[model samples]
Target: MNKLKLSGILAVIALFAMASCTQKKESNSPKNLQIDNKILAQNLAQKFIITDGHIDLPYHLKSMGFLDLKNTPTLVDGIKGDFDFPRAKKGGLDAPFMSIFIPPALQKTGGSKELADSLINMVEHITTSFPNHFGLASSPNDVIKNFKSGKISLPMGMENGSPIEGDINNVKYFFDRGIRYITLTHGKVNEICDSSYDPVRTWNGLSPFGKEVVLEMNKQGIMVDVSHISDSTFYQVMELTDVPCIASHSSVRKFTPGFERNMSDDMIKLLAKKNGVIQINFGSSFLTYKYEKRLKERDSLKRIFMKENNLTGKDSLAKAFNTKWLEENKLYADVEIVADHIDHVVKLTGIDHVGLGSDYDGVGNSLPTGLKDVSGYPNLLEELLNRGYSEEDIEKICYKNVFRVWNAVLDHAGKNN
Candidate 1:
């Protein structure tokens, strides 16, 4: 019984070991790990209250002529923009700061305040029109309350300070009207500050009135947004403001070199030092220089094509040509690059300073591959989990970091008042 029985026992042991090894390998395989991470990411997205620093739904609605109460139902899913009730719910977007965007042209057109008021009114109308689906949030507490009640919070952040209309009192007025943060300027210098996109650099920084506006904003408990302001304006505002400021929809300039619209590495660090968050934008151009370079080339070619064909951009032929070119070129950045921007911020500052601020609707058709709409947030969170981000870190990136700044602004205002 000795040799035969021993060989049989050894074979059984070997078979058991092989089975265990195979099971372990299957569990740890890349495909299984990705699926596990995807599930975890989706759970984290819904478990935590996700607050996107900026979403251009209000402006997008106005442009589409769907800002009226009669057309409000379209926002449930009938519209074409990146944000809608169904998509926001699917993505677990609890609080998305609705951009009350006042185009710079309005600053000269003598109707900045009116346009801002109208946009704010439209947001209010949305909340009223769909009470169960939306609520207006003026503070972090409001967001929390809305989240608990299963309502999406529509906080307001003015894209340009043009609505202040040269009146210091309008700062308080806007705060009362639920403008939580205000980007000093956009695409051009305004009475408040110089825009990064403006070549003129009108004030070289904040105007004398701009400094007053910043202080007024602080006193009113409004977070000053430095997203589109010039570098000089940023530095000056940082020196003047008492509370932490946010770059609501800006990404890191390190990724897209020479794009002042995105914050620099040094700027991110400073923002972190003040306990502020830089919500990373998901636009392809904001994620990498390649996209910007390709965009420039595409624009140049389009101009040449238009000229050669004697067609305007609005012409159907030119539109078709542009669409076809984009389809063939396919230069969009993927979700991984967006995670890279978040990683860059986490490395330069910390996880507390980075948050999501997908410029939906505002970025046109240049959103990154997996982040093409509000519903794609889970994809980014899955990437973050795969890259070794913990649930706590994801929560901070999702909402807590921004809430800290918002609460601080409120506390400062309370003490001064």
Candidate 2:
């Protein structure tokens, strides 16, 4: 009748059910399993700090048409399905690199600079409004110091390179403003280099301007992100930067090769050689091969339709159906898929060069059930444990590897200590 009574009765029923199943099959052979404390830790280390390399909260704040960014919970509600402070705190996300995403379309005019300004303003708003909850960090030391001071570090990273607006000096300008990393392009190619998702050819690999961007970012101690660049472009980037570059939100090409989302085995090995980390992305489309292929196929069909109907510009076509499909299959991807990639990277490049980058709020709605947001990080720890990862290894994947890389970039960049 009461809560305790109800719980005990349910437990008896569950035990009886399990006993019946075991009675039916006299085998301890393993299948799909749901593990509890004997197999999982109830109170894992609270001091085990995990840093997510990517979370697009600032961009979502601006684009979601919200004026007040003061209340984090309210903003989380507005996201409908993205991240928030409470969710992140509960999820063990100690350090989150908030992407200062400048949309690719905005790069055409002075829009790049305008977008950068707006995004940077959002970062300022987060720090100023919520000082106790967040702090702006420039280097890995900033992250450690901020975290130890009882505040979460919300560092800024330039997601798209168009923000520099062709001026290499501004790369240093961003790094001075606590911007730690920069992705060369977005979904579309920019003045600097070709896009991995876009077919249009701007430069075969890193263009002359792109070369300068890499060199300058390396010198400024900003980590170069090669997530959205083509395979040719990735190799070219490897050649350009003396320091290591990160695939901040990417997975293994062993899962999906044709899709530009994941990197090849060769790339992984090379990334290790430079002491770079491949933070596995948790997007369902990127994790599932069939879903990724289906989305690409749907988009290709839509392109053909666009050409056939003499469509001049973009409006409201059914081009984004793959997005809908991804939403439907979001459940198929779980912590196991995430662990699988981490395991592969560890096996290929050792555990030092693999990490977690949720890519939250950037992709469409297709996240694993447990790893749905910043709050769901414990699920990853649980999976890694099941996969036989040591506590030290888990902590490394959580943040140490990336932190080490960050520190390495700082030393390599020859920044003033």
Candidate 3:
């Protein structure tokens, strides 16, 4: 009995000593850069896996022929983009859903299956080609397996419903190919639904085809994503989807109404009741109300400029604008702003429905300042911790609630998702 008591006492002492040491390390670091913040932030994410539900890796890689993810360019080096395997590990990022973003081809020549194939090829190329760094995650078990194997999760998700091209079988085909969720639309209307960001309201709400698509996704056990969807389409999905859904990356409409990229308080409330989570999008336009107006105005002017220059609908124009602005101005959203987005969702919908989806790679150079890379996640946590968020709540925002929803959807899906 004495020996057991001694062992227990020693264990308690060791734990205290370790915690005390950790606190000391955190307090002693004058700068937030590379000062053991990883360990501190990870401790906060332990209640659930530290996860960012959406990451546009394939799109970014396809768009920008950038260097390998294993070797990323840091913010200090003035290289803007910085999400890599090492950084994700440092951030305790467990399950990062890699979005297979299908770019809009006006003609719709290749068809959804071919596009799905391209997306799958990109995912497979990343996961199979580099086994040491990443793994294919199809289910919650896959997440655990990859985590245990010291590998980053490369979950496949579809950003635009067009990949299904009005066909229900494609939804199941996507699931079989390891797609877990499907965003209803993106920037424009498709056969499935209308987009909130579209200048012309294509369907006002979900079309009959859209309703069928939602039903098929639910039957297939896939979580329906409502992020780039029109308000009516959102409501339709809301009423129709039995499984919990999510806004993979969206902001609060109250903060920036006309942007139409963020969800309203009423929508947020409904999402909460429906057991859905909205992973806060970290784009500057999404965060501040002013930026939305600014972005639209600037984008409009740039479009006129491109048109005058005979460059109609050139996608590369946006990239050029981003590069120009980043080089010319010091204006960038801070890590606090990201925390503010998280706080907004927490304030409007409570802590349960909020999650982080940094929208890394997709936004290119527009990432939140201190959070320049996956490694910079700790800075956001420190800001959150400073704001009086409990370790438990942070866990839910970081990953627990997301996982809970994922698991709940899994239960609903029964066989897949």
Best by TM-score: 1
lDDT of 3 by residue, 203-285 (tens): 78898898998988887877888899988888888899887888998877776766777898888889998989998887776
Ranking by TM-score: 1, 2, 3
Please give, for residues 243-357, the per-residue lDDT of candidate 1 as tens digits.
Answer: 9989999998988889999999998999888888999898888889999789889899999999999998789999998789989996899999999999999999878888988
Clashing pairs in 1: none
**Mind giving the per-residue lDDT tens digits that candidate 2 earns over 127-190?**
7767887788887788789878767788777888988888899988888877899988988888
Residue-level lDDT for 361 in candidate 2: 91
lDDT over C-alpha atoms for residue 313 of model 3? 60
TM-score of every prediction relative to native = 0.92, 0.81, 0.78
Q: How close is candidate 1 to the true structure, as a TM-score?
A: 0.92
Error of 2 at 124 (Å): 1.7
Sum up the clashes in candidate 3: 0
Rate residue 351 of model 1 by lDDT: 84
Off by over 4 Å in 1: 1-18, 67-70, 299-324
lDDT of 2: 0.78
Screening candidate 2 with a backbone cut-off below 3 angstroms (N, C-alpha, C), the clashing residue pairs are: 91-375
